[model samples]
Target: MATDHQGPATMLDVAAHAGVSRATVSRVFTAPESVAAATLERVLKAVEDLSYSPNAAARSLRSGRSNTVALLVGDISQPFHSQLAKSVAHVAEDRGYSLLLCDLDHSMDRLQRLLTVLPLQGVDGIMLATGDAIETPGIRAAIDAAEAKGTRVLLGSAQPDSSMALTVSPPFEEIGYLATKHLLAQERWPVALLSGFKGSVVSTLLRAGYLRACLEAGHSEKETMVLDAGFNSTSAQRETAKLLDGAAMPRGIVAANIPIALGAISALADRSLSVPDMVALVACEEVQLAEQLRPGLTTAGTDIGVQGEAMALALIDAIEGQAATARALVPHLTVRESSALS
Candidate 1:
């Protein structure tokens, strides 16, 4: 009679089947270069037969380095962040590294816990993308600890702190300035600013740029139009509706980001306003949805995927101590149907 008990296959079983030591099997999986080609082939064949996958934790314990990195973002659901994550994952795979993603959801406490756990789990590096300004003490401490452990950290679209390493994102002020300036060039004076969160760094810079453009165009203080729409579509729609209901509405509107642009379009539709006929609209970041809208949105933006790839490469360099300079990618404007006036 056959016994019913059967133990799961392990690295030792694969090593025995391949006629190699346990260390050789570990090397075959973790550091393939360290194993001879013939030996690696044998080990791989044995692994396939046994349906064995290497244990990442055990390999990291023996190798003193985890071939894994963590990407932390403020809002994972946002189109920009989702695209960035995909880009990073692709690059990480090319470099023989795995990526772990964590969404902070704009919570300081959750971000802190992620930082704490990532290092303990032997993550080789971290990429941080905060939707707003980076000002939390927990974030600062996490950066310091990662640096102390010789783990690389890269930040995108976040203000740099002297204590941590970073890659500068597209100049948000430039995005805002260019969007508003485009409206102004169309002979649309007194453009209204539909801003994001009050304290967000991107919002502050964009707002300042819009105001500066108005001043440069010789618009009076009262005529330098502005409105705070907050973030997200619902808030933007509500704020924009209020503006439409008011006694006066600006001839042009500058939305802080893509989501705001979508909301602004909806609000205008509700008021039976036509794009570039009654009012012109411009947005800071352009996504696919913008183009699919009834009238494509004009926007000032940089390639988010390219930025993500650059950030990953930069973080790898920092991790290996090869480079020490902060890098910045510039923004460019794209003209679309929404801003066209015929």
Candidate 2:
């Protein structure tokens, strides 16, 4: 085995060492299927002996492709967003691309700037979960600017009515409907919705579905209770505690997400209230530990992994000059002890 002590071994070094032309070495990497078996084996052995690796930057420059994708998300610490990032990265790797994940920290200003900057950095595609920032003019303009630079874009989760890129979104309203309806089926009345921030498109859609279920159950709008719980467990816990302190607590609760459901459960336990015995609980979104709680958390939502895979593939298609279409995933309910009548 020969070690290149002068910086690092180049393709020329590997070509000379392997007794093959530099073109053959390039073909071995770029189109290994086109190379003969013995030649491929010889090149691979030489590459291993010389510790040779392709220069991504040089190849990208030659091919006019960076072989990189960026995923811009709001709060990657959240389980849902983190799951999305993992799923996208897995698919990107399988498709011969690398993923660059960025968190906006729920800041519109940061999102606006990144939307413009990532494309300029030569990312072949971008998948963004813009949250409520999608409504802003600056974000939209930034998205437009990114597209102008030949970077394909994909929008996920909370999208605007008219999307600026290919979108793969879950059926938020259906998730809420199914969660509330499950509680209602359990013979629980006066179900309340513990939703995310008030102005988010996700919250609004969930509220709409909650109200629809209440109405379908012959309950008036006045009978439905909706609480604003921010996007995390802390806010949800605080809000749930306040609700417990108030007069007239609903018999059932539909939480907008897994974090909200966990918070509500914590609040109930702190007050010595038993789940499904005194009050029933359900979450409109799914998480990995949904079934591991004291009483398993029931959820009604699309699989986050599937959603992420779809988003990445759509963006890659758009990047490769193919027309990409928007996708709307339907939600499915998973019943568990939290929402059970017995």
Best by TM-score: 2
lDDT of 1 by residue, 1-342 (tens): 111225657778888888889999777644455566577668767865775645445445535667788898888877778888898899889877889888877776656556644564567788888757766776788677766755677777757354554665667877888898899998886588999886677788887788878878888768775777776778899988988888888789999877788898899999899997888999888666667777988888777777778888887666666775555677888888888978
lDDT (10s digit) by residue, model 2, range 220-254: 99888899998778889899999888887878999
Task: Report the error of model 1 at residue 151, Å.
Answer: 2.5
Evaluate model 1: give its TM-score: 0.78
**Pairs clashing within candidate 1:** none
Cα RMSD (angstroms) for every candidate in the order listed: 11.4, 12.4
Q: What is the lDDT of residue 300 in candidate 2?
A: 92
User: TM-scores of the models, in the given order?
Assistant: 0.78, 0.80
Find the number of clashing residue pairs for candidate 2.
0
